[model samples]
Target: MQVIPLKYGTIFKRAFGQPDVFCQFTKDILGIEINIDKVHTEYEYPEPIGFVRSKYDLFAEDTEKRIIVEIQQVKEDDFFDRFLYYHLISMVEQVGGYQAYGFDRTVYTIVVLTSTPRDGSINFSCAVSDMNPIDEYGRTFVVYPHRLVFLCPRQVNDKTPPLVKKWLNFIEDSLDGEMDEVDYPDTFWKKIMAAIQKQTINPALLSEIKDDAAWEEAKIRFVAEGVEKGLGKGREEGRAMLLKQQRETVLQAREMGLDEMAIAKLTGLTAQELKKITK
Candidate 1:
């Protein structure tokens, strides 16, 4: 399949707005079906108390299976902690906190992460409660909505389970433009293309992405963030200059018999600033 990866914004729109894509993705990855019939973020989950809002790439669900999936793009540090927070909120919201029943209705928490690729670390790693920690067994802690499946594209391989393979391939191929057509679901190709076309549109952002035909121009755009940061520093210096001028003016006034309170009120200067003016 000729899979095309989505840009930052398009990810949210396509996943939530396109139910076919959303529903199939959930089923293929997490082995569950959602009522994609009516999927909306603010409409469904309705961010609750203490939930950190706007910290995720996608807050998704397969309502049929009562499943909620959050996609987090990991940058560094064990920021998975935030993903964990969102996941817990999702679970809490689903089961109505401490009041609701059936804490384990096969809830699946999935994370799709893109990072600077690590070799040797499997491209896909899945974690399930080690079923036998006591006798080499562990528990799933059925006290809340059931399972969590995280698909870090930086971690998968052919050895990955079938479902995860489809997802990992989706992410990998979409990124590199060399999609493994045979391995993915039939509809995967079309869904991805539509999302990408949507991204290539909006000529303004498109121009921003593709600007810099000259390598110098490209380099400047890439490091444009540093330029933006320097503007902050520049503003600090400008403010200092103005402050220095104000201090000098206040000092001149004081030497010429201006009252300290009068100088303070005129310059809107703090007592500390006024002291500097005098000194």
Candidate 2:
């Protein structure tokens, strides 16, 4: 009984897209609590004409702030650029008129990446900081509410917070189908496990997941085969080039009036081999 990867396409969306689960997850990652009623999952919004469609993993709006959660399985070069765009769009959608200036709400962006970032940090956070010349004077500076949090599961370690560490362990091993020894707070774990199990039991969904896994495996094998063939061809070409150089050396020695035995000795070729080349 193979378990579907929790980070893959639809399984990821279905597993964490539940209202209760996502809200709790938001709390765990950001250390902020929000009303469950405000959380919306798989929410779609209109994009510019002639552009691709847009959908969000989760959207939560409260009296003072709006939160957007994104789960990324694969890394992208323009990930931050796109995330800023989404943050801006979410802010734009909230205010319709110029008079709504002071009525703007704070926006928080959360991204969970299964792949580690290039800097090798386990967790990354960005915020609107107020720069000060020196902190020794105990001067306080105001910070903006626009913030971003990145969670990288690969880098989680003992230094991580207890709850978050346990949760990350659960997510990393979710595909193993062996949760009996998990030591997390049981209620939260059970809630999330139930959501995962619900989708895992669907026959059509399971088939699609299996097919995608097979395709990925086949693609990897195809790439490996191509690399192997390329190396073999390169080796053959190198051997052929060496042989051509050796033949040229033999001819050059013969042109210098060297005798058959002398040429054979100088070129390290047997008399019979030298005769074939000369003929």
Query: Each model's C-alpha lDDT?
Result: 0.56, 0.66
TM-score for candidate 2, please give it: 0.64
lDDT of 1 by residue, 57-166 (tens): 44444433554455444434565676566556655555655665644444566666655333334344555421222423554344433556676665675678877676
Which tens-of-lDDT digit does each residue in 58-120 have in candidate 2? 777777767787877544467766766776677667666676455377777877666654555
Global lDDT of model 2: 0.66
What is the TM-score of each predicted model, taking all chains together? 0.55, 0.64
Clashes of each: 16, 0
Among these predictions, the greatest TM-score belongs to 2
